[model samples]
Target: MTSVKDFRVEEEPTATDLGRGRFVFSDRYSVFDWGEMPDHIPNKGASLCLMGAYNFELLDVNHVPTHYVGVVEDGEVKDLGECESPPTEMAIELTQVPDLPHEDGEYDYGAYHEVAGENYLIPLEIVFRNTVPVGSSLRKRGEPADYGLDTEEWPEEAVDLPEPVVEFSTKYEEQDRYLDRDEADDIAGVVDLDQLEELALAVNHILTDHAARAGFAHEDGKIECLYHDGTVKVADVVGTFDENRFSYDGQQVSKEVVRQYYKRVQPEWVDAVAAAKQEAIETGEPNWREQCEIEPKHLPDEIVDALSDLYCAGTNAYVDYDWFDAPSIEDAVAAARDLN
Candidate 1:
């Protein structure tokens, strides 16, 4: 029966920064311009905090210098006398790196490169994917010959890639612009290119292995690195359903739950969402006309149970070969009849 008390605080945990360095991330959820919608995903905050702490500990064990100290459990407040466990969600000690400048809500890397320089949180989100789904950029590339690069044959079907594909994105970029190795290097100047590549590979392997253990293939994951000084460690939550696509026995879930929801059920308004997003890109105005549409339609009680069970199953399924955590995609369709 664990619960967090303080839900929103922009900065570190204590009034005075503990030399040890403690920071607590916000549990606030947002999509597009919409923040804090009508519905709440039960236990999502707890799970996210727990997952982040778990990865930090894992990286610490592997000698990675991340901004992680420990979990701020159910009762811990600013420490006075040392008790066994503290209150609230996980709060970890992290280096106080200065955040970069942004004007008109745009990342000004020119300023970032000056002040943050080496200490700047690498202004990028790196993604690695292992499968080509329906609307993937690769799928959009289509099967036309000599359209662009002389890429190898790409199957129309959702095919598992032979190797994981890595792409870099500017931090929090909604339309995720792809970056070449040279482009990535140009942005993260202090970042060692060879090391970055190796790190990405290592992260993929680690996540893939553990996700396999968790009954989800690591199909792909992302990591953000901030170079304080010497060491490079994985930042953000690693190998979580939220961070990566998790399929239960080939059933689509993860962000696809939201993605497909936008694409399928409300195709009319959802298309508007996409079109609005595209307009933002073309005009440099992020004015998504549709924000809180219909208060985020809720799932049936049975579907909620199914989703919980899916997560519970993923929690256990990766332990073995049987992908028991998720209902077969066909079976799930039958259950949808219970919903509106």
Candidate 2:
């Protein structure tokens, strides 16, 4: 079924006793809290599928357990082969998603965690940041000085952190909110906070090392974990463009490109969306659009084409294969930067 991201989960026939499903990635893209936007970035799905499977394999090599099984190739589940223009479906072990009910727009996460017990999602998105980029929530939420930087304020450009910073944010909520360690620990229930943090760091290191080898700066990323059998394993897709922020030559090369495009081209709409979200928080109502009376406009065709090229070229570069006949990653990133 459809979820926040532009993907559908289908039950695989081989999943008889095994709780397995296929994540059929789509070309559709989403930014901010908006669901599928009007524009579709071509080859985006293939890029994510390939990159995700690549990272999953890397994690496996590092002896990290994950829900990833393999990619569906030639109508069968098999190892992810050479990079393809458009990757095939991906298989993952399924886990229980317990109901997290809300009362009057306020989530009862404690009760939800109680019901979740073990063998479920940890209910927190562990975010690991290596750099604070422009428009990063960290810039707005805290000061650079607070992060041990000499500057009292953050610069307009991205600034690398003195050390990697790991934070927790609520997942599966209407509006995901960043949480302090104690709050996160309580919500995560049986999962040990320190162990979870270690896993996030390890996963970040894995992705960061690979990104460096691929000539991209792995600025930040988030991962979800599955707590099963008294152990926590990396769950869900990891290290894709959508899940992580990557930069090339000081320019964002990930989905941040789309977010920046919207901020520049549709400032009014973006501001309206932010205002709506704030109003929702203040009023405790879920329908922010009704309160704000604003709708996000679709990206122009040229922007969509640029994004498609970026995804394809970036994928090719990261996978080190001629997956698509597109411009080089540098050229695509330059084009995107020109838009900004």
Candidate 3:
């Protein structure tokens, strides 16, 4: 099970084939690599499932390959448009996720690829960025001119990029770290690095166009893929708020709202989490969470309510469907902004 979803394998895949499974999305959320937080956002699971299904269908229409099959309702798999209500479980084609071996403070990708033949999940996350927001890691890794900004320094607020930037990062590591093209290609195993980047850029463009039509800014997001039979297909959920950062009228319309809320109300815990990760890297301990002393506090009721509305409203707007009786996106963003 993942931090926010329960994975159930109904049919196992052969060495050369795919399997069938279902992802039961949950209301649980995670931040700072913490497994699970103390509060549950109402209808969050359904919202994610709906948005994910919608985007998968959109990708299929655009000729992008994915692992999505359908959404589950009443023990039957059906198309998202056929679902009478929002579904919490998504039916998917399963790909092998081999255990990434970490030893002596180093990950052994050679060992990982030895067992993960073809038909396995790629061990890298392809991230695409159209804008660099405040507190973005890009600010630390690059200068403003690097992303085509005219100024010598990054602006205090979010700034649009002249073109989308695609990056790669470790997916199965204890702590994710950005990778250069050489390292990324090595980790990709059988998938061609250039093809992977092309796929990611396609996804980014599609998501950006959809978000634009929905009146939201698709700032950045990451996608994981499965390599099988000399082909790479998008795996796991995509285009959801959890996987992407989006904004409406300069206000967050994604999980960033909740992340910022924690930063505001639980700075100590957040700092402790960061410290623990750094300590883990220095000490070569794999489980950095154990070193974290402070735990996340439960979110306030008002904040939870606001986040629920924000997620639901944003989903409705993006999909152009009233799946939930949610308030207008403007009202939801206003409510969440007021909490800050």
lDDT of each: 0.54, 0.82, 0.92
Taking every candidate in turn, the Cα RMSD to the unseen true structure, in Å, is: 6.3, 2.7, 0.8
* Candidate 1 accuracy as TM-score: 0.73
Candidate 3 lands at a TM-score of 0.98
Question: What's model 3's overall lDDT?
Answer: 0.92
Query: What lDDT does candidate 1 reach at residue 285?
Result: 58
Candidate whose lDDT is highest? 3
Give the per-residue Cα lDDT of candidate 2 at 242: 89
* TM agreement with the true structure for every prediction: 0.73, 0.92, 0.98
Shift in Å, residue 186, candidate 2: 1.1
lDDT of 2 by residue, 70-125 (tens): 88766677777742335658888876667888888788877776666556778899
Q: lDDT by residue for model 1 over 41-102, one digit each (tens)?
A: 54445445445555555556666566554665444433211324212254543333455554
Ranking by lDDT: 3, 2, 1
